[model samples]
Target: MISLVILSFTVKKNYTSASTNSFTKTINTIVIDAGHGFRCENGCRHGSTGENITEDQVSYEVSKRIVAELKKKYPSVKIIESRPTPFFVENRARAEFANKNKGDLFVSIHCNFVPKIRDVRREGTRTETKYVYVGKGKKRKKVKKTITVPVYKTYYLPNPAHGTETYVFAAHKTDDKEEIIMENGDIFENEKDDSTINNNINDPLIKQQVALWTKQFFANSVKLASMMEEEFTTLGRFSRGVKQRQKGIWVLQATAMPSILIELGFLSNSEEEAYLLSEPGQQQMAESIVKAISRYKELVEKGAPQPPVNNGKR
Candidate 1:
């Protein structure tokens, strides 16, 4: 199992920094990020707006349920939330908060956009060019060809695009994830053992290992993502499968934790939108997330000694 492979802790003797195989300490705390808030400008919603229940509202609702279920199941596990209200939190700030609180995992929840008549927007680009003189003396002369770049707009109209999908930072961008994790060591707090505190930080190999650990995060992210999609499909939700999204997915990369951004469903689709706003739908979403997390936690903790961890924190 991927969980068994990842749960195996790679404890380097006499080393400092985070434990690459530190599931016992790492999975003790969880963080939930409810994506984008409802903000109106000129009587129009600015982001993820549809079906009367905005994306943020649905995410928030689903997140609250996830928190409740996690607590109900784990009891002693610590849970940290990025937002406690219907407010907007910048992606970087959300990641920062998760790290500051020493969250072991970060789950960002969002509803996919269902393009609509109102959701449609126009955007396009054009180009222009000029020619210079051949010789130095001739170059000094003002010689250019005139051109008029035409303007165009693509109407992003409403479509019946709906599904439950999960995302991780583009795995190919491993260097970025490594740098982010290294700069913010709090994510690796599990490595701050008294024994390894004095371990040399100058070792080139240790740095390499730290970078390799980031790759593991990508792997784990993908693993958990697949689990969520599978869970959703089992529940009769249309699963779009997992995908790597680099653009517009900052929290996944910026957070120094195993992170995943989930698109619960598309608001454009009536049936999906109804489910998203319904209590049962929200609860199911939360259940899927909790199940995935529990499976992951169990797999990683297998065979590994359950060292007592005082995870009694907010």
Candidate 2:
């Protein structure tokens, strides 16, 4: 299992200087990644599974809906899919595809899961016979004893941890993010020429530029994640809020552009699983995401100042 970690970092002078520049960035291209799919080597790679539904299936369904809705509402904006079908796509390959297409934002959809709660109860008592030594030394003799033993039956219940949350890459993992940005500098709309930075990654100026871009991406990711959680909350869903893991999520950090992975809800919860599998529930989730993306685009184009990054509201 992949565990998540959270940490905090302060924004640097470079990012502050860059943020004051003219608002030239626009969210022209968005990449939507369905969490998992079928992998031949490992068979099916469903992220999490419920009694009758799987995370891969739910993610694909929600992603497809989001694609359709975005196309309908923002016809001029280009939308790309990381996994168009229920087939495996390597994590690195997915990030490369997003960068290659010059995606402005990347949204990876997934389901949350927790182990079922185990409950044990004494169902009844059973009679048992055992041989025991009766008294002391010579007087002691083998005796048959009848005893009653309590029998316990264990059962599983769905985990109660059901809610929606979003994830951004950890701040301490900036090196990985910086390397990706250095490799694909052109993806940063406000940054210098791709070749210039890529060719002079070791140069002090280029290194500073990459670091600024990395921080900007992190800030944007946190902003977008917060907006998504807000949307989920507005839709009457519990919001676990934005989160970051100390260990980097490959899809989130590997992409050059701002990226986030959304945990729609806990599939291990029976009620949430039914909700995720239902048509209304899926449509509502897609709508919430689409709404958030629309707002994020507007804010970015308007040059809205990014909110300060913190430990996040868990």
Candidate 3:
């Protein structure tokens, strides 16, 4: 089991002629969000045994590991844990904490599952892949061979489609001023952005900077995800690739900072569930998180060398 302890640190800042207090350097605070709670029941089960692994327990365990890792490596940085224990945090509270702290980043951890398909793939221009949950004592489907893209990194979760993934949304580019035609054919202004937010995307320079930063954040997340996979692999877990999701998710949408929700592995997988609940597995995950954060800090200070330049149209 990992420990959560909060510490304080100060930043140095120089004062300008007119300012009484000026911060010379910015001290970043990271908000670690562990999704779901132990008390809530979602009908979710462990993959390998079809046993129950409550969301609270999983998130709590993962969060504890993550916090411990961050503190060990980034002692100067402030870490505000959203869920310290199993009973106190919820999605709304998590968002509120970030907002209150003005967090530099937010990360929510989770696990994934495929209850429908066991493990099947189909070839396409690239390749189509599907994940199926294989229950205990259930020999469901034959492995289908096709040219589809592998859903996960092979280092950790080797069976296929069982591994870690990260994601970010493509920038919203629909013209803000454009009128929306209702069913009656009446035009109404789109209100996603009012006048204040409009200026952000309207400025070409601002848009470029935002896009660049967001991309960099995504790359950083991928690096962390890869590191975690390696750590898990060393401890004998599946390695899923750092993935991108175009669709909006709750944590992604709510986070004020660029964020990623990692589906570490499926509790639905019996073997995975047992491992995740084990002390060694948890420690491996924690160590991976620490390593990833260390790498991320380096990239942030020096800049990601291979930053994705794509405008996200693809």
The best candidate by lDDT is: 2
Q: Candidate 2: list runs displaced more than 4 Å.
A: 1-24, 40-45, 132-143, 185-194, 304-314
Q: TM-score-based ranking, best first?
A: 2, 1, 3
- Candidates' TM-scores? 0.74, 0.81, 0.57
Q: Candidate 1 — worst ten consecutive residues by lDDT sum?
A: 1-10
Better of 1 and 2 by TM-score: 2
Could you give candidate 1's per-residue lDDT for residues 81-171 as a string of tens digits? 8976777766778988987776668899988885565443334545677775645764566568656576655465668788899998886
lDDT of each: 0.73, 0.80, 0.52
| Residue range with the least summed lDDT across 10 consecutive positions in model 2 | 1-10
Off by over 4 Å in 3: 1-27, 39-52, 88-92, 116-161, 170-208, 303-314
Error of 3 at 37 (Å): 0.9
lDDT order, best first, reads 2, 1, 3
- The list of candidate 1 runs beyond 4 A from truth reads 1-26, 39-46, 116-158, 186-202, 305-314
> What is the model-wide C-alpha lDDT for candidate 2?
0.80
* Number of clashing pairs per prediction, in order: 2, 2, 23
